[model samples]
Structures are given as structure tokens and as C-alpha cells.
Target: MAGVSLYSSPSFSVLCLAQKQKLHFSVSGDNQNVPFLSRSLASLRLNSSANPLPVCKPFVTRFSDSGSSVAESEPDSSVIKSELQSETLVSEPVKQEPKREELFAVVMVGSRQYIVFPGRFIYTQRLKGANVKDKIILNKVLLVGSKTSTWIGKPVVTNAAVHAVVEDQLLDDKVIVFKYKKKKHYRRKIGHRQPITRLRILSIAGYEDYPAVALSDIEPIK
Candidate 1:
């Protein structure tokens, strides 16, 4: 009674002892339940493969929509204004003036005429068959200060005086003229000398009558 007690059911005692140990065991059964879990995971994987995730696209900022984007993209207004001003400031071409016409004149002497500008005159030899100086008056003027011959037509300038003296009146040797008719004993001869005079156009009057002919028109006959 003081030492030990013996049990009649040994198996029950062993069971009790096992209970007291609190034994735990990992499941080692066949993979019969695993197929359902595997199938569920496979289904999940198939679904993920079939419906892939959407990819993100890059964002595009339009100038019209955003004020900051517009300001940064556009050119400066001050530079544009300066370019316009430069174009407007261009200079125009200059026009040149026309030239003036120079004045001049012409003079007439006897039947022949001569061109005479300011400060110039001409003295030509008199005609061969002209009459004696004292008998013939050289007052008749053909033209005066006009380009055309019709200026001094029939109206002679009354004071248009001219005096001429015989320069070389010595009788020249008579030149003989002979005409023969094919040895028909017919011949003819004639001889004569010519007279000449040196005319000094004294003073041209009535030149001042026309405003075109001034005191300056009377150039010394040089």
C-alpha cells in the first residue's frame, strides 16, 4: 500500500499515457484532395494569361489646351514687332531733276548765211559777179537770228548796212576758150577777167528789235 498499484487493463493505461503525451502527426494521405486545389490555382493562372494587364501610354500635352505650353512654344511678340518696324522703315528711291536748254542764235549775210552763236562772227569772200561796192548797197538781209530761212523773207532790215571795198581789182590774164568742129575750119574764142571785193559787214542794226537778239548778239566780226 505504501509503494505501488498495478492496473488490470494495460491497453487502457497505454492509451492514457499516449493521451497524456499529446502526440501530433503530419498528414501523409494520397494526393486525392490536392487535384482540386491544383485545378483551382491552374484556373487562376489561365485567367491571368488570358486577360493580360493594360499597358500605360505616354501623355501628350497640346499647346492649345495648356497656357504654359503655349507660352513656351510661341515666339516673342517684341521680336515680331521689331521685324515689322524694320520693314516699314525702308527708304524710298529719289527722283532726279531735268536739265535746262541753252540759248543760241544765227546770223545772215547777203545770199549766203552763216551760223553765229554768242561772241562769234564770220567774214566770207564776196561773190565773184557782184557789182561795184559804191553802186550796190549790201543792205539787203536774207535772215537774222532764226534757224529757218523764212524769218527774214522779203522784209529787209532798213539799217542793215554793209560797206565793201575792192580788195584785189588787178586784171587777171584772160583765159581763152576755143571750140572746134571736126576740122571744119570753124573755131571760136572768148576771154574775160573777173572782179572781186572785200566786204566789211559794218554794223548790224535792228538786231535789238527782236528780244531774241540782244546787245550781246553784236559780236565783233572776228
Candidate 2:
């Protein structure tokens, strides 16, 4: 503002002269000089198109290898079916047969308890009124057991009996009882043999009279 001067530029002189002459611009309807502004816009569009901005290329994903991997991992239907058939074939030979039943019982005969098995002879206290080869039926069964189950009675199993044949009547070894007194000079000796009966078990029956199976009919474990 200190060193500035007026009437220095040509544009300032033209503005002063136009103002003095009272000159002005007026736009009419339908007919106008709008192409001058349109030409400037068109020139701007041409400049933008002639020198375009840099374009970036997008990265692409290839699925060909992934598809191949999926195919390789998938199991074949035919191979799965063949494997099941092979398992069935291998299992067939290992199957086994049903096992036979085993049965026995604990019977009270006279004053002693005896574990009786079919076809086996067991010695018991001397039985009265029983002769050789005579089949004797005992009803004092305490417990009856089988391969799968067992039944125990409160005192004795009712209706369950053991049938045995008398094989022999014998006496046991002698047991000596000696009495002695030192300084008294008194001595005595006594010997005795207990009577016993050897009986062969025939069968054992349950409440329903189902006969017991012997060991000879039972099959051995594989």
C-alpha cells in the first residue's frame, strides 16, 4: 500500500473506461453464447482422457490345484465296499459252538455233608437199611449249583433230591486211644473203626424234576 500506484495495468484501464461509458452484459432467452463455456469444459475432458491416471491390476486366485487336492483326498466308493466285504469274510471262521451244561449239588446224608457229582462215588456215614446196589434218594439238599445259576435253601431245598446207588459198606482206619498215669502204674488201650458207606451218585433233580447232566456229556472248553 505504501509503494503502489493506480492506472498501472491494462485490465484496470479497460475497466475504468467501461465504467465511464456505462457498458453492461445482458443474457437473452433461447439464443446465447454458452458454447464458449462448453468449449472450456470439453477441453478439460480431453486433457483428462489424454493423460489418464495409473490403473492397478487385481490379484487372481487359481483353484485348479485346490480342486486336484480335493479329488486325491476323496476315498473311492469301490474300495470302501471291498473293505467291508473282507471284514465279514474274516469273522466267519472264528465263531464257536454252544457249551454244554454242568450240574452238581451239596447234599446232607446222615451226619455229614457231601459234594456229589453224577457218576462219582462219595463216602458218607454208615447208612442204615441201605443194601448194596440199592438206589437211595436223599432229600436233604443244602445248595444246588449249575454252570450258570445257583439256588440255596434256608434250611434245605425242598423237592430237590439226589439219587445215589450204594456201592459198598466199609469201616475206616483204626484210631487208638491210650490212657496212662506216671507213678500210678495204671495203663489201658482202646481202638475203634468208624463205619462208612460208599455210594455212586446217579442224578440230581430240581424242583421240577429236571435231571442233572453228567460230566461225560459236557463238552470241553476250546
Candidate 3:
């Protein structure tokens, strides 16, 4: 007699083989806390030999975060300083001229000395001993300094020059009268007309020609 077969069909034999070969999953003591990756670890391995690794960008820290480190990382501070210095060196210092002092001179007229200041007006006057309608000459001068005397040498006054006419005229008003309080007394009056002369001052000489009057030479008039 033939022994009865436990699996009669070929499909039942395949199913029993699959059940015997089924793999049982279990956690190892060392891998209990480890995560399971969906892809195999071998597939995640980088093929460095076939393809070059990507270079990582360096992190840039702001200057406000770390002052000393940021300053150290800055490039070529000395070159910037040198360039600024070179720019300043190219410019030249400005030169200035020395200022000169101004001098002045005047002509002495009558009892007064009329020194012409800057923008002063010039005119003429009559002298003490001038004749009627006669022109008078005046040579009074004040040398401001040594440089202004050269202009004083020429005849500063001229006769019949139109500039010799005195633009302003002046007269004395004081008069003397005689009277007698008596019977048959007569009263008389007398007046005098003072003689006047005209004078004109020419140009002021250079400072060098200025007359030097000593202290003893300047005597007070009585």
C-alpha cells in the first residue's frame, strides 16, 4: 500500500514552505533605542570616489556679535590706511603773502597841520602877508615815515594856480567905538580891515624827505 502524503496539492506544499521560511523580526539589546531607516544603510553610503563631496560654505559672523574677532577677520586695514595717507600727502599747503603796514603824510597850513588821511579832500587858503589878489605859496609838510620824503622836495605851492583859491572865507566881527558924554561933545568911530593872503599846498613828498625836527628845535611859541 502507498503512504498518504501530508500535502496533496502543489499549492499546499508551496504554502507550507513559505510558512517555514518566514523571517521573524526582533529588537537587539544594543539596537533597542536605534531608529529604523526605510532604505538600507549600504544605499546611504556616499560614493566619494565617483563624485566629489560638496564644499561647505563658511559661516560669517557679524561685527556687532564679536568686536575683536570681526576686526581681526577684516582684510587689509593697513592698505586702507596707507591709501588715505597717500591721498592727504598729494595735497600741498597753501602759501600766504606778508601784509605791509600803511603810512600817511600831511602838509602844515597856517597854525594847523593838515595831514591828509586816506580819502581826505585837498584845498587852498590865504597866507598872512599876501597882497591883494596876489597868490601865496606854502611848503608845510609832514613826513609820515622815511618813505614819503621824496615828494616834499619840489615847490609844493604855485602862483595863480586855480587850486590856490580859498573855498571858505572867514572874518573877525569885533569892532571898537569911541563916545563922550559932555555938552557939545562929538563921537567918532574907527575900523580896521585885516590883510589876508592865499596859499595852496601841492603834493606830499615821499617819506625819506620828511624834515627831522629835534626836540630842542621845537620851541614853544610865546
lDDT of each: 0.50, 0.78, 0.48
111-189: candidate 2 lDDT, tens digit per residue = 7888988878998889888899998898999888887556676677778998889999999889998999999999989
Clashes of 1: 0
- Which ten residues in a row are the worst by lDDT in model 1? 23-32
Could you tell me the lDDT of residue 103 within candidate 1? 22
Among these predicted structures, which one has the highest lDDT? 2
Off by more than 4 A, model 3: 1-76, 106-143, 146-205, 212-222
Q: Give the TM-score of candidate 3.
A: 0.24
TM-score of 2: 0.47
Best-first order by lDDT? 2, 1, 3
> Per-residue lDDT tens digits of candidate 3, residues 168-204?
3344444676676677677777774443333333333
CA lDDT for candidate 1: 0.50
Tens digit per residue, CA lDDT, model 1, 1-222:
422344546776898888766532211122354655544665788888999876544233343457677787898999999988988888566788864322232334545655433333344444566544443335555445434222342465444433334333345447888888886988888776653344433334454453343455557888
Models 1 onward score TM values of 0.29, 0.47, 0.24
By lDDT, the better pick of 2 and 3 is 2
| Pick by TM-score: 2 or 3, better one | 2
